[model samples]
Target: MKKFMLITCFIIGGFATAQAQQTSPVWPGCEDAEDVKACFNQKLAQHVRKNYEYPQSEDGEYIRGKVKISFTITEEGKAVVESVEGDKAEVNAAAKAMIQKIPDMEPGTLNGEPDDRNFTVPFNF
Candidate 1:
């Protein structure tokens, strides 16, 4: 009986931990949003399209790359760059710029508690 209880507790604890980690930022363009996400997505897309000025390369420089960056938003609603994957130089620079300039994203919530959240970005230049 004691062993059964211990195993059950472990399972429950593991489940809780997984749930906690599952918490993530509300995507900037979720369809369920009333208007906020749409507004931000539209504005952000414009900002990225305009701001990312790829350096000229001899091969008619073009960045056809996609970067997935995980970021966090502070409790006060600020985007923070976390990790970036893709072209080391350009992707990192673009990711940093996106976080710095993209307007605040609505912070994500978990278990009904508002908290900093993890999110991703994809860039194609």
Candidate 2:
């Protein structure tokens, strides 16, 4: 009986912890989505793929690398790029430009209060 009670308590505690997770920000068109985080990621990837363009090198050489970009989503649903890091300058510039084009999103919330959310995406060129 003691073991059963302990297990029950543990299960309830696990559920409470799961419920306490912060909700992810919703993308512009994913406001009504059942799984906001999944929908946001899908939309963001699609948007990036649609808008990505490889920069031409002056020396006519192919540049192959990945650019990692970090940005924040403000309370008012604006994307602000924090940093872009990569091997090639062109790749970094392209990554920043692409991130800048992301549409405004619905701010994430914690306990019903608006919260700023940070996101990182890597662009392969």
Candidate 3:
């Protein structure tokens, strides 16, 4: 019984230590997001400009809409899309396409360690 208790205690301690070490990605709004928004916006814009797909509307006019793409930021500042939200079909496609085109970001940091963070990117055509 005593041996079992000691082993359990050690296991619990190990888990606690590991959990304490885990960190969350810190965004600009998350941590310094306000400071980083400009950088984020710039990067996002560059991505859109490079990847923008101007599909024609049913009326032969160009169609453009805003879409919000939500993604996770890795500890190394890479943005990984979790999901997207919007109405226009093309906008949704653009959101996914643009997200795929996003270069790995400088991962967000928390407690000096890389962490997962979520960010919303708005794509307007």
The predicted structure with the larger TM-score, 1 or 3, is 3
Best by TM-score: 2
Better model by lDDT: candidate 1 vs candidate 3 = 3
Sort by TM-score, best first.
2, 3, 1
Q: TM-score of model 2 relative to the true fold? A: 0.78
- Candidate 3 lDDT by residue in tens digits, 1-125: 99999999999999877765444443343345554656566656766788877777889887777777888777666666788887788778767877776666556555567767777767667
> Worst ten-residue run, lDDT, model 3?
22-31
- Model 1 misplacement above 4 A: 1-33, 58-64, 105-113
Cα lDDT of model 1 by residue, 15-122, tens digit = 988876333444445436566556556666777787766654568865456677777777656877888788657656765776676556556566666687556767
**Model 1 lDDT-worst window of ten:** 22-31
Q: What lDDT, from 0 to 1, does candidate 3 have?
A: 0.69
Off by over 4 Å in 3: 1-37, 58-60
